[model samples]
Target: MVYDEHESTARFLLPATGVTIDILPGSEIEVEVIYREIFEDGVYCKHGRNVADRMKDEAGAGGSKQVMNVKALLNVALGDRVCAAGVPFTLFPRHPGNSTLNPEERIRVQRGIVEPYFFEGARQYVVPMTTLSDVMEERGIERVDILKVDVEGAELMVLKGVQDVHWSRISQVVMEVPDIDEEIYTEGTIASVKRVLLITQLLKKHGFMVITEFDPNGKNHMVYARRI
Candidate 1:
């Protein structure tokens, strides 16, 4: 599930994933073309491409009327491990680690690049996962307006690599957390229930405020925040 926030204060949730722009009264929208980049993670099934295409369509329709240049970092996985162990196994932008892998099992999992099932199910395989900081450093990006994180259960680990200085450059963030009753069990690991609280606390500590927490979607919780 996806939710997008625009300028207009349309008080209803549409329950869909598409690009929409709302030029609200008394609200100002600005578009700058100096190195416009859209870094998309979890590019499984080219979901990010679909989103970018939608954004382009919206932009052509008299929205973001500035001569904007768009760049993207789509489909590059963002996590600690390419895959982890659990009921069926898990995949990430990095290797989940071999702390849980047995001698024989590890050998087989390490043979070749782990591939994800084309469908919506988690079929175990080891692959390569990358990090946001690494990519940003490579591109010499000093600031990130929006950082959207949707790693299955390794969100915290990813955030760990972001230095405090980088926090100052980041203006907003959108992340997924597990629901209170729901537990994220993957790669022979179980994420803590305080995951959301931890994320909220950390972001707040870094000068960001948790402005919006979407209604729990039975499976996970979505939190949107901005620097204060």
Candidate 2:
């Protein structure tokens, strides 16, 4: 299930064994069985276990259990939060890491090129994710109305460093969660969907509502959020 907190309520998306439901009003609604099977083709066995076998095993050994596809489940929960908030937001691009480019180019650009381009737009300042916290501190930024974070595979790390900061002041966040692709960064590895869930949980805990998610063909998956 996905839940996002908005100004006064929450949005929800729930996916059951063979169905998916989108809830925008934070209230229950009756849905027919037909709507539940809209994307039956995408369903599959988990961990090599066929559906029947899994069900039989569960039935035999049942107490109360919650088995889920982490990625899909997280998406649903995030969707819920977004529906409640009723906010509009956009996703940001992925941040290219130093390992993605040649050492000389990375150094030259880090020290020489980025500054000019970062300041070219009004209310926009681009900097490496690793240095974001430092930049915020140096700039005396006590509040961030909107934040766009895309730090390649280092998104989790960047978020980790600022977990305890005053994130309530942040009205929006658009972050890219890296996927498996060495072409982008030598250090890149397959980021678990569970890790993404943790990040979303953190944001939700701080009163931010995920508003939307974008899965573009040639780019990293993005999660967009706004403050409750």
Candidate 3:
């Protein structure tokens, strides 16, 4: 498989190896929302601006859709608020839960300033699935409508950190998952197809049904699931 010279480009050029099967839209989200803008796009970047604009537009008049974006370094379109967190990571072989970064890895990730390579570090504080909930609760976030997790290969791990009680609070999930096998990674630590499937099953058990699967590029699959 060919790898994109740049991380941002890869997001659009990669070939999708997995399939996104659609199910049905579940319920409406009427709570606080969390958009984990994991990787920072860039300062002065319109990425976040555009998202915020669209969200506000959709929300319409009197819509109380507050968003919290957790960032790692890169800039993002500002939202209701922003929080700093290390990139979440775990040893390969695909675990069932999440892990934190060691001191060394934390330093590296904080300073790496690069793509897939930074993800290859020893440890990082990238927010974990549970952290999202923690931040929400800390901010008195009672209900959550949408969670857009696009954290490279750690998507599955992020989901693993969320529990049933927390799941009940979530309305819709938009996660970017790669076709495990086809994903072009220099580090070879990306979650495997088996792992991604396990995540899917976990979501299913939690009452989420896949509503749509589409290739954002040819490399990764953007999955949208809603509570049923």
Candidate 4:
């Protein structure tokens, strides 16, 4: 199953993935409203500004299994919020959901200076938010043999929401937790090494043997976990 809030890009890129990823109109973007913001394109650099475009141009490989596309923002908590492409004021996945964020880190994110690689954009839209556990229960999903997650920096939030699913159903997990997360490594926490331990520890707590030998992007480690 594939879950992405942006319908147009999701359908456009995963055309052959085989699922109904219809482009939801702007008004149909959310079921529950969160907050609203009108942003000015304050791009700091070209690299950061075009990050979203780059993702669209580079579609990931898909498996042969049947795919079900759901248009909703994946978060630990569910809500209706703005989720736009190239917009820095939102999609702060690096946020650890904790107060560990230093002043500098907080400032950068607040000013739309941290994500999309720190580039601000002009697009804006609301995204219906939901969690994996909620979706599983809603769909009556009982088992997931292999789970793969790569959400820039919201890896922990997604995993945390798995709850019973991770403990009972999922047999193996392959994910990429971006080590560049500013919130993942906080005060006195080393960014390079300790960041990975956080993921290893989480899986271990859930009765999984973990491995991280394949890190395609040196900054983001691809973690493999199997029920022991």
Candidate 5:
């Protein structure tokens, strides 16, 4: 259960797996150089803390700041769109996909990379976005066998935030899609098509059985739904 829209935290090791990157915000050398280019060589270990402080010391919990309070770490009840959650829609400088800068010091700015180092005093965080029925009703989590998603292109806002009666308890799903055809309005349609044909018709209208695997050269695709 990791959600990185940026708040920052890290911990990893692969050969003998173990990873934890709860939240992401930026610059700790941009979160240890983008997960050390996606893992390898001293496999991460930023720590930084308060990612619930182990369920708030196993429930002796006093005012959870599992991510800066306000019903954070979920306890629900947030309306008025959570008091207009940050309105800075777009200005993404892009590097390691969601970079706010420090991609090797914005490539050691010679003369080109200086636009306030991609937001010198950048500030815009709203973080409190959850779904998959608010984390399977806040972690009672009956089932989710597998649900690997790579949010580079926001993969259909994380598969339409699951909930067609919890998409039949989610058997499997391995996302990372974006096979081109950009039009992006999705559930409202704006035209062009192929985001692997709208995530293989939204997991074949929920019954699953989808299977795409592009990248003959690279538009990046890899959808594989199950529950058939």
Candidate 6:
């Protein structure tokens, strides 16, 4: 069996070596192999960025942390108006829920699966999954404290949109980085380990400190970070 240099797919040069290795082209094998390779090498491994370095960069940013999740934002507000760095701001819930059913149910019915609830709160703004940076820029908010993103598998796109944002005020971030294999391949979503690693590196360069991570029971991983 041979894996490609890009690591996108593994080909079985010679049939089973009696090892019966499940050759899941874009599945668990991909995640394990990529992760192991990165672990063995340093930051600039075959992948790219390591978790530790990314966290450090996030911490060093000077921006006002913007909590992307509506529930989290509400919790921070605590009955008081939303304010970051003395700058009064409005809370924007990207995908708000409807009154007919729970948010989780709404998402599940929309996706045709019993998935977890990601967004909650009043309908403030219905932004596309890939236009986070555009929303922020349009709002004219200079400093974003923490962007608590939990968009099922659209994290990569969201991160991509904000690639040019000033990292100083966008200090901290907490996102759910789903299992590349399960979420993307198995579930037929547009997620990949390569994309995740790319976004991780971008965050690292900006000064965020990736602190905690929760692996999916059998599906995804949640990465939490803070600005130093």
Off by over 4 Å in 4: 1-122, 181-193, 214-218
**Residue 159 local lDDT, model 3:** 73
TM-score for each candidate, following the candidate numbering: 0.48, 0.37, 0.43, 0.47, 0.24, 0.39
Candidate 5 lDDT tens digits, 111-215:
243334544443343434455665776666776755666544556766777768888887777775645564767687777887678788988998887767675
Candidate 4 residue pairs that clash? 115-118
Residue 69 Cα positional deviation in candidate 3, in Å, after optimal superposition: 10
- Kindly indicate the candidate among 4 and 5 with the higher lDDT: 5
TM-score of 2: 0.37
- What C-alpha lDDT values do all the predictions have? 0.49, 0.42, 0.44, 0.47, 0.51, 0.43
Clashing residue pair totals per candidate (backbone < 3 A): 12, 17, 14, 1, 7, 27
RMSD of each: 15.8, 17.7, 15.9, 13.3, 18.6, 19.0
Specify the poorest-scoring 10-residue window by lDDT in model 5.
42-51
lDDT of 6: 0.43
Model 1 collision count? 12
Q: What's the CA error at residue 198 for candidate 3, in Å?
A: 2.0
Error of 5 at 85 (Å): 11
lDDT (10s digit) by residue, model 3, range 6-50: 132211111233433221111011000111122233211222233
| Tens-digit per-residue lDDT, 147-209, candidate 2 | 655443445555655635756556667675643322222366654444456667778888877
Q: What is the C-alpha lDDT profile of model 4 across 129-188, one tens digit per residue?
A: 556777677777787656666554556766767765436787677775554443455697
> Candidate 1 lDDT, tens digit per residue, 116-215?
3211222254434556666677788886756777555556767876766677878777776544332568799987556777778789999876743444
Q: Say which candidate scores most in TM-score.
A: 1
Whole-structure CA lDDT of model 5: 0.51
Stretch of 10 with least lDDT, candidate 3: 26-35
Residue 146, candidate 2: C-alpha displacement in angstroms: 1.3
Off by over 4 Å in 6: 1-130, 181-195
